[model samples]
Target chain A: MTRSVFFVSDSTAMTSKGLGRSLLSQFNVTLSEHLRPYINTEERVDILLNDIHKTHIEDGDAPIVFASMMDEKLMNKLSQGFAGVIDIFRPFMPTLERLMDKKSSKEVGQAHKVGNQHLYQKRVAAIEYTLATDDGLKTTDYDQADIILLGVSRTGKTPTALYLALNFGLKVANYPFTSEDLPEFTLIKAHLENRHKLVGLIISPERLLSIRRERRALGSYADPKAIAAELAALNSLFARESIPFIDTTTRSVEEIAASIMAISPT
Target chain B: MTRSVFFVSDSTAMTSKGLGRSLLSQFNVTLSEHLRPYINTEERVDILLNDIHKTHIEDGDAPIVFASMMDEKLMNKLSQGFAGVIDIFRPFMPTLERLMDKKSSKEVGQAHKVGNQHLYQKRVAAIEYTLATDDGLKTTDYDQADIILLGVSRTGKTPTALYLALNFGLKVANYPFTSEDLPEFTLIKAHLENRHKLVGLIISPERLLSIRRERRALGSYADPKAIAAELAALNSLFARESIPFIDTTTRSVEEIAASIMAISPT
Candidate 1:
């Protein structure tokens, strides 16, 4: 039986923006959300109770409740109220307090200060790179790029790009392909003639379907036939362009980024 | 023969501080301190002339010079003064201008305006994780970190950490081990036993010595024997603690980070 978890916070906690969703996908856990900024603790408790009232949680179902909040009294109340229904997990709060205390004792070095500069430059560069071209592949801003990434959506483009930009001072740009761009010839023509170095990301059809289904309701777009076709087309484009691609179907974004750097020009 | 080119920029041009040194290491490049803000064209030209004079490149040692500048007149003066000696490479200006122009036209997206709460929370959590204990593994500050990087130094930790914090909305922190910590296993033991997820970074002894030599001119501490001993100790610590580490002697900070994500706890 899979464990069901609810992540309740502002909009940020709802999305796997930085905390590696691809890595989490491997576990048999399902995460749902109820997030809003203005809702106070009492309001949140009410809403959560309402959600639980509606959810079909069986007698033996395991559910975890994760929250990021500023209210202590409300948290205590909710914790006491939902002790039986959920395993309340407040993950980031303790982390924040510890960081505040540490900063008070020591000053970061000049070298580390320089690292922060690189991090900022990379992010600015990534956003700039994406805005530069329509296909999201070409960039005359080559000198500015610490690193540039190219691939399809849900193949770990944004996170990897942000990781490089945010974590390694690499300016990264990524572009997604629409269904129209899936034809073998179109893929070849769009990405092949470019002089910029390209890295391809390929995912397993099953994983792609699962991700797509989660994005919307399960539909034709998330069907196996469409996924297989896209994967096959992606393979052909990678081959024709001589661009080395990774099968991200089972790998984490960190792995993909690592592989990209192993072969990057810089 | 490797090409020798000089990169000149002032404070603003020197994005993320110490990266200039890394770029210099990667390329046969000479970086000059001509990048100063608010200076007039005449002074800028004088600085360029001085850098050229100091190098004693008689109009043709290397035909290209990369300068990040805002003054067109200064660039023209530089071109005329040196003639065959330099061809200025101002990579950021054109892109910067284009981006500025495009920004006015962009329709802000819901995602952009929503402020990625999750990313912010995760960052806070990561910072808290680093600072929760007196373990010298990580350090953080909002002003200091942008992103705090937790790892042992010489693992490309300094550069990668800086790049992330400076280039993006991140704060980075890094720590290094001294010979005193080599024989003692207490630090590593306590770190692992406490469930602290330590990010270990390992580099080749030879490369560590070479890099240390560049930073500190031929000190006894940088000798091969000392470096080898320290690296061996680090390896043993990582192994015993079941810490995941990467060999980063040959890789750049970007590559190291990519690899870190690939292996880090999801």
Candidate 2:
């Protein structure tokens, strides 16, 4: 029987879901996954318990719950009714508490709470900064950017930049380099100055063709020969400039962002 | 003495960081947190151990490590050297293995790996769709949207929409509702047809003024009286039309997205 897995939590269930997905990737099993968020109230808890019980009874296998709930009462109740309860926080909280000689607040949804308004506001400002400088607009303010991405059109630049800005609170500015700009390949003043933060992104010509063609079914934009020439020029330009780059052809945005974050100067 | 906490992992260190931050938020301690990603190599692990040992000796307290490493050899070395090793994956792995009657893969960074190209491509497509429909552009294509966010200026719609699309793989289309459209707050045919997917977003006049003024130092757009009237009219429009709205005055993009995800019919 296929096990039904649940990522349940008092908050957005994101922490539970992120960690749970990672944990489950290790196992060889056929399972259905569901996210149960905002499980703070007893009423919500009761409803979730009903689902877990129903799934277990129907599937003939106890449903496994990966929970990040903070409330003691809620957790105990859940553990009592569900034999497959796996605490996602592990048992390290007590060790940490003892080591520090302090008690845990045990509050729910503390991770996502806007406790520090300054940091939160800075994140919002980073989003604004990334958006205003998107697609090479307003490059005069590139000095304020924490990172800058350079790539040709449809090379996964905008999503990667916005992901960095949204997730890591980094002001990312992405400039598009079209095929026309290749013959006289010269860096703009902003890019030349912020060369330390420059990241080049490239995609395989075949994949680029598919992606671009999806956007514009007609035109020389998705022409195969032109795409190959453009990528070759981009590769040479990156080598000449001694800039680090990532190939997005087979990588997820998370993987690309992680590589960039690991190599980011800041 | 302050604890030098490290979120160490073989992959992006995001899983370790996300869960570690939540676990640490429970405790009351002064933590100098560091994210150590891509520690998949023995040389990298050696370098990380050097930092941990140095912090332990200098601070007269062992550095706490929250590791999500999947390699059995690396985890063994780490646990042997450090007394404060906290495995973020916990003891559930063996249990899950037994439950599933299968051996674990023990692979690194599997969560972020593009194992399913369809899901990965869908996520990228969602990002593109969100950008193409950002700020009310291409409204005719709203029929294909998974969710549509309606808001006045400076109401956190664009960032929220992008966050939903990028993180959750939702085809989010956001349309701007300016003060000029207050009296004539009529839904276009596309939005009217997809009214079930519409989510109205609002911000307090005080916050709106501050945000708009940050973009433009002087303008009737940031005028206090105008901002108040705009919100009041928008509220009545939402009420009359029975459109559920989210107040984004103090919420983070994650928070707003969470609420929407929980309430979204789709």
Candidate 3:
């Protein structure tokens, strides 16, 4: 059976959608998803309520509403009319009030707004640094890097670097170990100079072969034999240098980044 | 007085922290923030509760708790002890039940578990495309891009492009306008070829001047006169070519990206 799910929020609806999707995925059911973002107005909420009621009647079931509305009056109105209204914000406000001994301001759309100029500038700078130092393109600024990620080609280094930069406001630089730099004991000059910031990433040969094949079909880069050899050499190199490495075979970029952060100084 | 706020979650605590920070920022108060992630155990909840009680006695105010726990027993235990417990998830579950006419799975940490392989691969491929075509580096692949952002130096083009790629899985390429390309009304070869995918970004001269000054202390790039001339010329060029442009002076990267998505065909 198909169930309708609506993610409603005063801002982007990203958080609502994320949490809703996660919870819904656990059930053995197909979902028809709808997103209603920037729903800060009473009129907008009314329109959404009408739509929800109509969906409920037409589908012969109540349409589930995942709402992150911060306004108390609007939320109360929604709860009164919709039986399936999931208030994402109100349940937390009373507890916060008792703790701080102050009532919440009940403001909306403040989470994703550019509130702090200093923090915003830092994030922008990190993004710029990530782009500039990507794939070891420019090594002159290695000293400024917060962390450096090294991995073989197509081993999930670039996405990890960008994730670190975006999420944590970190200046992350990533380098790839090409075939020419492999099968030897010595490290590259840049890696040697910035050994302290090095974090290695390695993937299983089977996974690496498939990823490489997607990028360049019918090439030795995707050969299982070559991939196995490279991974073995790289593993030894990481062990020799005492560099921490993670296998990205079954991990997401977030998992890989969190692991790197936990192990690395950055 | 300093108020303490704890963001407790059974998973990454990202949603709890995001919404909590946004709501708390509306009040003019000093807050000591803490995040307690992966609080899935009864033992862990006991420790958190003890910490909250101690903070309350020490500060003479109860500590604010923003929790997204999915476990009913743990949440009940928390509410019984913590006067300031904000239940982030449970309040919405009942409404969801009535709407879907089914009980929730009540699972945790599933929102960002790399569930869909196809979507994950698409996001990775988009990131690669964005890095490859950044700052007009590889115009040969412009035909494959979903969107192209154009602006003068430091008009918030790169961050917007990266945000589009990271958030929406869109292949975004950005180009900066230089003085050499100014004064004449003719479009560049690449712009002429992919005019349909183009989205122009314009910023206020004062803001542009300051941003450029931050990058280069004393150069023509940062000069107010140079910024004014470039912005005027770029505006006329966009008008002449009937290209859509957004003013990035007051908008956040998220706002700018949403506007671009609304207007762009992609």
TM-score of chain B taken alone, every candidate: 0.46, 0.89, 0.88
Model 3's A-chain: what TM-score? 0.88
The C-alpha interface RMSD of every prediction is: 21.2, 2.1, 3.0
Residue-wise C-alpha lDDT for candidate 2, range A56-77, written one tens digit per residue: 8888887778897889889888
Using TM-score, give the best candidate's number.
Answer: 2
Docking class of 2: medium
For each candidate, what is the lDDT? 0.46, 0.82, 0.78
Candidate 3 Cα deviation (angstroms), residue A146: 1.6
What is the model-wide C-alpha lDDT for candidate 3? 0.78
Candidate 2 colliding pairs: none
Clashes counted in candidate 1 amount to 35
Q: Rank the candidates by DockQ, best first.
A: 2, 3, 1
Candidate 1 lDDT, tens digit per residue, B64-102?
343433355665676677643222223322332242232
Estimate the lDDT of model 2.
0.82
Q: What share of the true interface contacts does candidate 2 keep?
A: 0.58
Instruction: Provide per-model DockQ scores.
Output: 0.02, 0.58, 0.38
Collision count for each candidate, in order: 35, 0, 0
Q: How are the candidates ranked when ordered by lDDT, highest leading?
A: 2, 3, 1
Better of 1 and 2 by TM-score: 2
Q: Which 10 consecutive positions of candidate 1 chain B have the poorest summed lDDT?
A: B104-113
DockQ of 2: 0.58
